[model samples]
Target: MNEKEFKKAIDHYRSLIDKEMANEKVIDGKFVGPKKLTKKDKIDLEDIIHPDRPFLSKDAPEDLDSLYVTTFRVGNLKKPEVLTKAGYGTDVIGGIEFGSNLVKTGLIESVDDIAPFLAKYKIGILDLFREEEVEDGKKLDIRVYECIDCAGMPNIGEPVCYFETGMLIGILSELTGKEVFAEELRCWTSGYSCCQFDVDIKETKKGLDG
Candidate 1:
C-alpha cells in the first residue's frame, strides 16, 4: 500500500481502538488486561510439519528505528473459550501457529495431527480490551510482532508475513495525531508459531512521515 493509504488504514484501526476503549465495561471495577503470550509460553508452540526450536529472546537494539502498535490476545492452543469468546473461530483450519510450523518444517504435514495440538492451545484476543487504570503520564510497555504466511517454505526464517502489535496506545496516537511513548513498544519473535514484526515502531513512524 502507498504511504497515504497505509496511514489511513492506521487511522481507521486507531479509531477502533478508541471506540473499544471508551465502550469498555468494567467487570467488578477492574479494567481488563490485554491478552498476550509470555516468553516461556511461546517456546512450546508446536507445528505439524516442522521440528520445534528452542526459545530465543533477543534484546531489542536501542539504535534501531521503527513504528509499532500494541494490541493483545491470548495465544494458547488448548483453550476453546479463549478463541470463541474472542470472536475467533475455533474450527478455522490453518491459523498463524499452523502456518508458522508449516514454514519452519519443509513438509506439508497432515492437518489432523496438528488439530489436536491446536485445540489445546488458544490465542486470547479479548485481553486487548482490558485496560489498566493508570494515572495520567504513567507509562506501560507493549509488545509487537509481525505475522507471516510462508507459502510452502520449509525454512523457519524464509517466509514473508504480516506484522502485528498489541499496543493500543500507538494505534491511537497514529489515528489521533498524538505521540506515543517509545518505551511502550516491545518486540518479540514467535518462530513457526505466528508472524511477528521485529523492527522498531519508532523507526517506522519516521519513514512514514518522511
Candidate 2:
C-alpha cells in the first residue's frame, strides 16, 4: 500500500482500538505481587513461546516490523494482570533484562541515534528527543504515536509498560556510558493517545559520549 494509505489504515484501526481501550477500568493501585515462586513452580511452568519468537513464526506476517511489535506485545501482555502482579519493580527489572537482550543485537548504538533503530523495532513512528540540561546529566525522550503494549489492550489507568521504559534506560546507559533512569510519564492506558518516556542520566555530560 502507498505510504499515505498505509498511515490511514493504521489510524483507522487505532481509532477502533482506542474506543475499545476506553472500556477498560484503569487501575490506580500497585500490582499485587505474585506469591513467591518455589523452584518447582518455576520448573513446572510449561515453556511457552518466547515473547519475541512469534515475530519469526512460520505464519508470521510479512510486514516484519509491525508483526514483531504486535506479536511481542500480545505474547507478553497475554496475562498482564497476572504477570504484572509481580510488582512494579519487576517491570523495571524486566525492561532492563529485555533491553539488555536488545543491546546484544547492537541495533541502536546511542540514544541520540535511536530513531532509525527504534523504527525497525516498531514502524518508523518513534520520535527521539533530548530535553534541557541537567545538574549532572541530561534527559532523553521517546514519543510514540502507536505503542504496541497498549494498542489493543484495555486501559489500566497508569503507564503499563515499564519494560520498555527500563529497557530504554538500560540501552541508553550502555550507549552513552552513563547511569540512566527512565520512567513512563503518560500512557494510552491513562487515556492518552500516545506514549512518552523520559530518561534521566547520571554522571555524564550531555550528548552521546559513549
lDDT (Cα) of model 2: 0.53
The alpha-carbon lDDT assigned to residue 203 of candidate 2 equals 76
Stretch of 10 with least lDDT, candidate 1: 63-72
TM-score of 1: 0.22
Best by TM-score: 2
How many clashes would you count in candidate 2?
2
lDDT of each: 0.27, 0.53
In angstroms, how far off is 17's CA in candidate 2?
17
Highest lDDT: which candidate? 2
Pairs that clash in candidate 2: 26-156, 27-156
- List TM-score per model, in order: 0.22, 0.59
Model 1: lDDT to the true structure: 0.27
